[model samples]
Target: MIVFNEDGCIKCGACQGTCPTSTITVTPTYIQHCDMCGQDPKCAEVCPEGALKVEMFTVDENALDQPRLTFNSSLCTSCGKCEEVCPQETCVVVGKPNMEVEGFCVMCKKCVEICPVQVIGIPGIVEPKDCAIDLEGKGATYIVNCVGCGTCVEPCPVDAITLDKVGGTISIDENVCIKCGVCSQTCPWNAVFISEKYPVKREKDIIDFAFDSTSCIGCNTCVEACPGNFIKTIGSNLTIEVPDICAACGLCVKVCPTDSLDLVVKWGEAHPADAEGLGYDAEKCEFIGACANKCPTEAIRVVTKTGMACPSLVQTDEDPSFVNCIRCGACAAVCPEGALTVGSIEKMIDGKLVMRDRIEFNPSKCTKCGDCETACPYNMIHLTDDEKLPVKGFCTLCGQCIEACPEHALYDK
Candidate 1:
């Protein structure tokens, strides 16, 4: 049967939803266990944390077999109180306290009552011939820093990867995993690094990268602009090692003060590499319904957002102009991952509200202190020779200039 480590569970309902047998159930604050699915249990597969696990057990014939004691590590401080009170010295080891020692624990309740933090817990005693749970036999384990992308779940040949409904990360059932290394190679974040033990290796992509240190002033602009966090500045020297996870977004290239960094995308020449009007990146999108929820025209549709199982999509390119889209930047503004980039801005053009830049210019509050020009990471905002604010270059709508303006001149359109 599948049981939960109550302290570790976040009550996300990931396991309950994935259970094929519909045995698992979850409430706002409580979670109920389920009978194991016999085959690879789906409940264990989707658990983001390794709080839930499967254990094989047989009914103990002896009536005196004591109930297993569960430990709460969150409330434990290693006070050694349980160790001092527990009659069996083998039961309560200093750091690794094992409350359930077969034939050792006499159920004196001395450790339970003396625990200052109440970490030692004893559940109801099981009747004779009941399931004797062996808690130490939990078969699942999770790697550190799992991004909960659910990418590993699909590649597992044995279906050992867990799916996290909470959009956190995934856990792997070590017992079910064949160590084939498919999940390790498929993971974009390298959350599963067990591939090193096997022959599986990720193919290297052809990339053309260039950085001129002579022109670079070490202003730390590229580090701040890069969304992938591929660039790092140490004193005056910049370190760029983005072969594995670089999206090639060119935010670093645009924010470079001296035009020192240059990157060429070998796959596609386009900067965004998407359709003109409403650009969307499926790889970066988490299907959180932020764009579809905020889209005024209802142009974008996500299948997962509507509780559909398949055919997850945004919008088609049939209407590249996005005629229904008001270009209000509502979708782009609300998108958490910046997946949806609107091409047109909502502004008056020939008495028509065409898609235009979302940025607004207020000349009344303009002090022209040149702070906006300095604050613009993309170097888009600048003061003309006559000291007039001239926004000539491409604006990413990053809102850096708005924060930099002391007079509160700039505001979102």
Candidate 2:
């Protein structure tokens, strides 16, 4: 039998997991004595404090790789404190009740600190839990201290939000809320926000932004108006790097006097480093009009120039309008040529529909084939040898050039 120093043991459960024979048991408060493995016991070898040991025996220098965290079902009261604190989505500890620390675990150890019964433990490292995950870039739309102003009520496509006028509070019906973030976008008081959450490491999608630097009047309006401070004046030109942290509020887009900047926001996703940089182009479009036929709102129109395919909105007898686009991503989803991409995809999460409210264009994917130039009804776009397809002033910024390109390179951002 092996001896356990009760005074020195921290109950981290490292030894029990490291035991080669599975002869050791550990709990939050106590550890069962080991059988010593009849030699230099692995349990004693891994014990952080040398609390477990055989009489007059010295263990080997090398330690075996073991599970970083161990669970004691007997000690777990289903208190749900571990799931509340852990940042990883892979290791869910509440509903599933298993902290499988693989793939996504960054070893932040938030569960260790919040466990009420001290049931959660990290072996070998007895140090305090790390608070090092950078969470500024990840978040979801949340309403804080809503004043029931009703500013956000009219813009909501679905009646998922409500205002309690008497109580001066806003309540969102999670069952009905589409998570489109229109309420978060329309809130004037900045009460409804994409508030920060625990940092879960995810493969981020980049933001699509466009700035017409040639037409820029060197005005400082955008730099001063930006609330996120993402836009700055670089020499005589304006440069903006809107990454994941941007709130997608469109303040800078509204403030720019020259109409130089265009940003079609994909709320709650990361933006790319350069808006004009590379885009996802592995998929090509045959322009067979599937996206046009798939559009529920009749918003997409397919046209071909010299066998090159592009997408545009079906023209109505009335004014040019894309206000009907629900952003269902049906066009993008059905496109065999892979020409169209929606701002986001609709997902069901916690019984609520999380949908993309807009679509963004990417320019790096442009092939410079003059398809957009030929497709331009007003003939505003010109393909220069030294530059990408540059649009001239008095441009309508329509979807024509976007639809004309076979490569799907131009973005309306």
Candidate 3:
């Protein structure tokens, strides 16, 4: 995690006081890990250098005492509070290698309080120290503060550490360590250390949207309906072109009457109107252009570019037949531009339109399942699809038709 430089600590104990778990201790040299807590290590939060880090320990399925620590170098500040507070004087300092013995560690916790950096924590108790072996033969040592009390030994299921005095200094076998960090969490003194490697950065290309023209009808429905006003019509054929800023919302394809528009999955493909020399004109857009405004497909995105306040193409004029609409999709079904989609609360959210309680439907998908007709207590839902169309019906202000369409293909506005 993080560490402070040796002799860099001001011995203010600010970190220890700020610690929520009371895990830090002040001593003659610096702060260290306490081995009593089993899994909770709270010392890493206040460390100025972020030297205090966590490690993992892995034990064999048959043996559970093995544990190891994993370090994150990106977080380390190269502070040596670890060395100053270390009970063992031989511990390596951030930049120095002084081998002077500091003093016998009685688990006094004096060093923990003096550390300016909050990089220390108690190692967890799992394996007995006797079971540990120094693989590097680097003069691996343990503090006498480690009582034969065996409080820190058995928690390790892998038997990585042992407590027998005759078994030599406590050691960590690299092969046995699973990098589980359990031992580091249980230790009373902040003694164990771990290191991490940094990752390399790479470059990436930008992303954009594409559309197909064979299915397009040259109808400006998409251009007039787009909420973002990003999509524009350039040719009499109504060839639509998306700029680099196009978010690929697919609304253009949804509004195309002939289903001539399809989303382009690959990049760098020729534009839909490349042969016609026609491209969408972002500047010529008069009203918040189509694809985004009235798209039933929700393939176009207006909210991403212009945000929620963008005006919708739907007019507020109260339809004289508003009371007669049976929620039938006949009007949308006859639409040549695919602009008349049934309004719905869900569709509004998907289109990034202002949220409303109304529900709507797409004529393309509506099977006219008249569940709403049977449930209508009022004689409002027209049984005949063509007769119930919004343009040709005697709707009784009763909202039976609105509730009749299971597809939720009805709107009051």
Candidate 4:
């Protein structure tokens, strides 16, 4: 028989699962009682304490010597006086009708007579319950805090999950959910659930993005912005491939200058990081569009007050001296808020102009042999860089393709 010693119990709640007959139950404090399993006790075997022994019956007088807690289920009103009287901290003897007992119940019997209704058995064994397994991933909740990071969506093996934005509703299709528990496990916010009870359908974390081929310009900024490296093109094919890691972070959508990228933030319900080295203080933001220029991932963006999606919104620091804040005022020149000021930084950038299909280029340096054709993702340039991921006329002057150009043949001029 499995005997529960209240003193040795840590109240970890590890014992309350997967029992066949529902013989055992648990409260937050301790195992309520043992069903004995016809003399075979699972809780005793599972207990961290070797507290249970093979006694033919629980009536042996020695059972009282080890110190135990008992509760008369008929009389207990669950008013917490036993929990307050214990010298040990509250983890033991903590629950009222569901009491917790720490190491050993000193056996003082103070609890025996203290019950106003006389419900708590002097040293009571403890609570009961619905033993259920959720066949559907019904435990998921449409949280008020979905970030659309795509972390949860990527790990789901069955692809049964869907999600929307923060403050949006979400639902796991109970009919389709395989109940693998992947969404609840991967959620950083603890927002997704795989409960026995399905949370109501609210806005889901359904964010989607699309690539526009007509105005694509083959810039590959989206490629660079993608953390998963999910964007790729085999040859000069006009068709672009976006992979499953698409979480609609707006990293790529904000950087597309020709309005070639669109991010649909919320649509329907769906299944779904720690963003490192990232901080945004909105009051100081001036919508410069320079940070978007400087951002490696374009994670930070300026959203206009009119609610129109502006790819331009525009990081931080103590002079921990990690960032290149020369105080050059280059940002000041570009700040629409005029929040920043500069003294004397010089260099009139010779900007490139659009010619016909692409940027104006020096014909003497270009053979027009299509060597750079693959380098231009949009096929606008017949000859281009080899090291870079192929650019769209070097619009942002990110210097990736130009720096990697081996022959100095591709120039922004």
Candidate 5:
């Protein structure tokens, strides 16, 4: 059974939610208690406020030791409901008893509100009564109907109810089982049950990643963001190698501003690939194929029909940082031929080497709209079809394919 400090209660009702039994009741001012159901209290184990306490008896005589609930007067708020519903006459100071009393309390403390200063304390049973285990199967021993009021921490036998913090989940120590069944009987949620049917089991899942030679960009972003110290970049291309310690939290995917890093699960599932779709343009795209080079998973690759290198339509020494690339598929959207393809790296990886079917560019579709280039954060896209397009040239070399190409054959020289 759990006890409460009426004055200390904020009336949040968190204890009622955790109790395995429906033994706890809250009044406008204070909480009421039931003694018979509280022989072994589970309510005290779930309070997060530390407003409750557990009472234990000492064997030594002449010790002046009495197991009583103590409430801090400094904390009490003068809630009187604790006295209104107490089972014992001494437990409550309400006007009159609405129900008849069966017997005198044996100082069992079943009605004690450990919230010392404000609420009353009625003594009842101290030792738990031994009862036969009628249920053969392992089922919930405690079925508490929780009111979500967290007042039961006071009388817990094991000092289990810790209400000072968030309510933690319940745990049972099988090794300490005297099978007293106190916890099961006192729980309000009916969340606790005992079973002799099957053995207990536990399991956990782990994942790891490894970047191929051409996959990583050596950005070190994955290494810095990985919580498990699993990834390390080797060179400027962001080339990476994942160690055995990787837990695969996918933080690398979130931190990669270039959208280069990716996570591959054991079942062939890829991270960032499953992310939401973004818009892109296919026409007017210069096949410079920067997106493929920047991809960390090697999921994107450029395929050329001829062995000759495609001439660079534009070049600049200024490094364009991906930090400014707003991912507006402008370069791909204005292409004339069906040569440019733009999408998430994962979708690009799923395509065939030729990608002819996936590539889309229609000059007829062009409305001379400059919306695509205006959306470029790096200012890499030019509004005109001219090959020697003037640019701000802040390219980080994190190639996002140019969308202004009309030849359908432009490449990095």
Candidate 6:
């Protein structure tokens, strides 16, 4: 059913969006067929589809016990040898932006010996971590600076911030707080702040948490600080979440003062193993650069050159020498479109235009290999397989591209 059905899947990513594990990587070519490896394959192990006879393969124990592809950044020549030999499309796509190794790796040691500089090694693991936190404690500490000036009231896009006279403090409606950071930026007192990271509920006992209203001085700090508007005040009393409406964003919990919110999860809930975090299948990913904004870990940052080089993202007939592409060959390998090219030239950085050693690219033949996106040194790429940046002079900063982006995958602010 879900086993890469060509006729069924329109490839809009509705199922992948709902997939808790982030297992299904949406690639440019295909949804990444789950070659069922064997009777009890990992693909079939989690398939919500039918019991079809997929594919399989066997490898020698010694082959798997081989050294890994270690990157010796200092010695790399930016040559395309290793990437050309890489069995996995995403294994070693060296673009201007950084690239992360995905799960499709069959452990083939081709990269080990193929690397001209011997950068590949089998450390047995990349920087593996079950979780990461970006919380910036908006707690009671910042509330002291509120001063009840109400300067943040107008900028409060959601009206989550409100100052109460009886309470002699500012109060925030947590439910309505959107965490847009507008009020924080506009606040003259610099009192309001909110947590950038929120904890994902893992254990069964924790349904949610709350804030201490009595402890709340009603400064409306949380209201201005809350990106979600989760907390609010009713007359003199503070309240959050009306029983049925909680998205579990976790913003209100981390930003609240006095620990007013106490998580009361639904009794006896079953948490799926796939819910642990996110898994990205490189081969399945299409390099749309959409996932860059959603990932809290900054893990899925695929830079794109489409918008800058050519607004349509399609290839053009521009001469490689004119554009100053680095021609690192990283863009060539992952290019599903094969539209990129390489030649020596000069370009701009920051604001000053300077002459430098780089390559040229042809926008016409690119099929979206999406590999070169992460293989370059000056990777000015974005999400959606859109890596590498265009010549600075060509960039307009119109933001029209970002606004038009369906995934909102943007490299520049």
Could you tell me every candidate's TM-score relative to the true structure?
0.19, 0.24, 0.16, 0.20, 0.17, 0.20
- Angstrom error of the Cα, residue 304, model 1: value is 43
Can you write out model 1's per-residue Cα lDDT over 48-79, one digit (the tens) per residue? 33322334333234433333222444445544
Instruction: Please identify which of the two predictions, 1 or 5, would achieve the higher lDDT against the true structure.
Output: 1
**Candidate 6 clash figure, as a count:** 111
Instruction: Estimate, for each residue in 119-209, the C-alpha lDDT of model 5 and write its tens digit.
Output: 3333232322222233332222222222222223322344444333223344444333222233333332223333211111111123434
Question: Model 2 segments beyond 4 Å from truth?
Answer: 1-154, 158-190, 193-207, 236-245, 267-413
Per-residue C-alpha lDDT of model 3 across residues 139-233, encoded as one tens digit per residue: 11223323232323444445656655421234555434332334433332323321110111111112434556766667777776443355667
TM-score of 5: 0.17
| Comparing 4 and 5 on TM-score, the stronger one | 4
Q: Give the whole-model CA lDDT for all candidates, comma-separated.
A: 0.40, 0.40, 0.35, 0.35, 0.34, 0.36
Candidate 6 local Cα displacement, residue 361, angstroms: 15
**lDDT of model 1 at residue 52?**
27
**Worst-scoring 10-residue span by lDDT in model 4:** 320-329
> For model 2, which pairs clash?
206-272, 207-271, 207-272, 262-413, 284-337, 285-337, 310-403, 311-403, 365-409, 366-409
* Cα shift from native, residue 126, model 2 (Å): 25
- Report the candidate with higher lDDT, 2 versus 4: 2
Model 1: ten consecutive residues of lowest lDDT:
267-276
| lDDT over C-alpha atoms for residue 145 of model 6 | 36
What digit string (tens of lDDT, one per residue) describes model 2 on residues 71-181? 434444444443343332222333333422111222234433332123344344343333233323232335554545465665666786777552265776644544445
Task: Sort every candidate by lDDT, greatest first.
Answer: 2, 1, 6, 4, 3, 5
Lowest-sum lDDT 10-residue window in model 6: 319-328
